[model samples]
Target: MFLWRALRSEGFPFVKKILLFALPTRLGGALGVQVILAALAPPGQAMLAEDFHRVLLSRALPAAVDGPDAAPAPEPLPSPGVPPTRLDELRKHVSKSALGMEIGPFHRPICPKREGFNCLTVDILPRDQLLQAYAEDKDVIPFQEHIEEVDVLLSSGLFASVAAYTQGQEARVQKAEGSLSYLISSHNFEHLPDPIAFLDDAATLLADGGFLTMAIPVGSRCFDCFRPLSTTGQLIDAHTSGRVKTTLGAIFDQSASAATHSGGQTIGDRNYDVAQVAVDACGGMIDESSFGALQFTHEFGHSGGIHSFVFNPYSFLLIIEDLQACGFLPLLRVQEVIDRPGQEFIVHIVKISEASRSPLPLDAARRTELLRQAIAYYIDDLNATRQLQNSP
Candidate 1:
């Protein structure tokens, strides 16, 4: 080894590097062990040349054999995206426990004015449903034309004129202190060219975190149903102007015009599908998982079926599912069915919040299952409707 080292250092440039590694490694096992020992344990009187030879030999180790730090702990693989686990986190936060409030007016569809129930009674049409409920009290506040004043308004041939008047009244009440809720007409949306802009204005009018309740026809379920020219005209104008942001429940048969004079584009026939509208308009602004069935037909002395998407539980379930998909936290507490005295149903109630994710307690598998079930239900319901239409 000493002779080999001397030859290596004495200007043997051609064989220097190769001999340094091969000589030590290729030595017989006994010599290899000896060389290793000598390199690891420098003698007290070790020569400078010996030390230099040992230092030069150490760097021949492979990178795989190097220290952990030297190899670079593989840069931690980056995240794929917002993980599924994170979406579940949002769901937990979206649960009912997240909200704090009593859901409905004490006597819904009953004039809150009479019982002084600190809640708003929402109606989609000029119906005296609530007024009649509290007529004994005569505490009616004639802010706008409800069904109580529908006859009067109709007699004046000024039904459309009352929409603006009601919007103003709702705006005023929304601004008032202790205003529990705001009522709106479904027709008002059909009347306005831009429902979103109108809703934004209403949101502004509301108390911060206050309630907003309104119904809309989901899609073009009505076929050749006659509606007033003004009503259809408003919708057409909106469509032409590009203000129609939703197609969930728009009238598809608007061309038939047979129903135009009679409000042909009305949402009826147990298929007035507006799931998409609820999602687009209310999902972001409200909690969708909180929705269920508000199934009471106590108002209007009959089923307050006006604007009801369908007259059954399944219809509501589909709607709630849509709301959930749209990221709203839904809370369905009431289940009153119209014209069905013995049957109980839940009302769909969702709260608006600052959060954008779902608050329901569901895993990814369960959520996907829910989506599947909803789609299946839609297919069945649509097929059933078609069968009914074609039946003798």
Candidate 2:
């Protein structure tokens, strides 16, 4: 070992770097050691080429006191792209101590009961029935083991699913400051006809600073590739018109616009090639024989079985920003929007800031800029998906 040199603190300014290393004070693996390393050259000699700083963590490191940061004002022009943080990914973000609700968690519950997660599930079918429905398929057989018990069952529609949860309205109101710390869904948010109203209801169920995590399919990358991106105007119209059931137009669009999922679809952890039927721009999806029945039934009747909305990351953010800006989603603000690489994207929208009931309009220029960026992103995403599928 080189002989240790004791340097004066005043020489630090002229020195090249300060290195901190932790070595045992004694040769025998004992833990109490705090150290600082300094390499200094003589006045006439050239400075040693070294790293500016290097710190190695060892025994007795200082503990950190974590605290929350002050909430910032809402963004006027929300970006089309908001990346993700793996540190606070879906599973990690779900608090074990607090209650969480997962909607339509058929077989694969994100946080299973065996994993010690405090999660309650809501679905249209119970565990056994869901198992029966999806059991015959060899593909979903492996995940059948993880099927959780349905905590909340919605038979008719999802518009009142939150309010219709267990323990009645009186009890919910008593704890209405927020009943759940987190609410999650997988590929289900787009199914609701009145997504805005569902979000408003979600606001009622979610506590302050709670999170809503959703893993939704990207229209550009999935079977919905041919569908038009759900616009702010369409969403606003749906919300203001009080759509309780799926509209006939929405049903027609869902069937007619769905392209083959074979292109670049991902199933179980990036597995592909589910649907092999090649089609020309989603043509012949709705047969003439089925159109009359579909139209007659879904015109003004109960038709909540199809995807009422289609989205990509940019379009999603645009809608979320518009909703928040206009006070439609008064309690929720977008926390982060990230893609899961191929077929879908995951978003963590948090109810951190509560706004007034009144709408807060954004400037015309800002709104136009956001829309322009979103359209560009949509085109780029679709083009990239096509390129990827065509690649060798």
Candidate 3:
């Protein structure tokens, strides 16, 4: 029984073929008679015959009967009620938690009925000018309400005043140092001609462990998507050279690719159309004639006041990391990045001055490598999402 099972398990046809061809002629008749007896056995005890029949039906018989061109059986459909697993890992990374309890004076109850914490809100215009602008536009009323609650409203336009508070300004730095627990800027970093200086100033003002929370527009979803991603090198150059105008290339790209959110749709959906008028008026080759005419308009003409930089999340994080390594933004750790549904991302950064060790500077080559890796990762994530959506 064991020998029969082994032969059958090892594929009987090959063994049978070898035996039939290799057996001595004298023993051939004996083997053939045994095979006949096995085949003629009673059905109840005919296990070897049953096994042989099954092998023939499962292997050689089907192909012989159906021919070589038969189609394969259809695959089973995925079971219903089984949740899609594609985005589970991604959603975990993007989900928000309630603001951390350890955020020092900036801890929530961000808006208090009566002021309890010392906070500084930085803006280009002073309080009265901001109010006047608000008065002209009813849409600004909501912002005005929040501005009214601020303890100190600092104007960046007053260069001398800001210089007083920033590091290296001995007299003013001492007075303001570690005094402010919270500093909030909204939609302002992109307007700064020198973001490094602004960051240094904020770091100088913030108390040890204080929080700096800011909301910045995601460049790809904004009008600036047409513009190229700005690099730390570009920022360093602007800071060092005192360039007052956004490059002409940036201006032309912005104008040429200006887009607005489509009706009843979010920017994430890529439901947008070009603003043709903007292109007609502002987009053109920067030849001598056109350069002279368009030079002082749109982004370049506005004293670099338009979105001076463009960033997606990866690029933005890379800039922040490089800035910290360069010592332009020391001891600042990014605590959280919260994605807003249709608009911008909010970043919470904490100044961790308690640590005894200082941060090391990241070299230019390493910074570039890190930025490249981040961009590649983001691209891979986007490609994966697209592939998942297209799969059957």
- Candidate 2: C-alpha RMSD to true structure equals 14.9
How close is every model to the real structure, measured as TM-score?
0.29, 0.68, 0.54
How are the candidates ranked when ordered by lDDT, highest leading? 2, 3, 1
lDDT of 2 by residue, 218-320 (tens): 7766666667788888899998998778887887776666555554543322233323424332245456766876778776555545789988765787787
lDDT (Cα atoms) of all candidates against the true structure: 0.30, 0.59, 0.47
Q: List model 3 lDDT by residue over 255-352, tens digit each.
A: 54555433433344222333221222354343666556546574434543457787665577678777767776665666544444344656656555
lDDT of 1 by residue, 276-391 (tens): 11222222232333121111212112322222122222333333334444443332211111111111222222223333223534355544543443343334334434454455
Give the TM-score (vs. native) of candidate 3. 0.54
Instruction: Evaluate model 2: give its lDDT.
Output: 0.59
User: Which prediction has the highest lDDT against the true structure?
Assistant: 2
Model 1 spans with C-alpha error above 4 angstroms: 1-191, 218-221, 224-379, 386-392
Which window of 10 residues has the lowest lDDT sum in candidate 3? 98-107
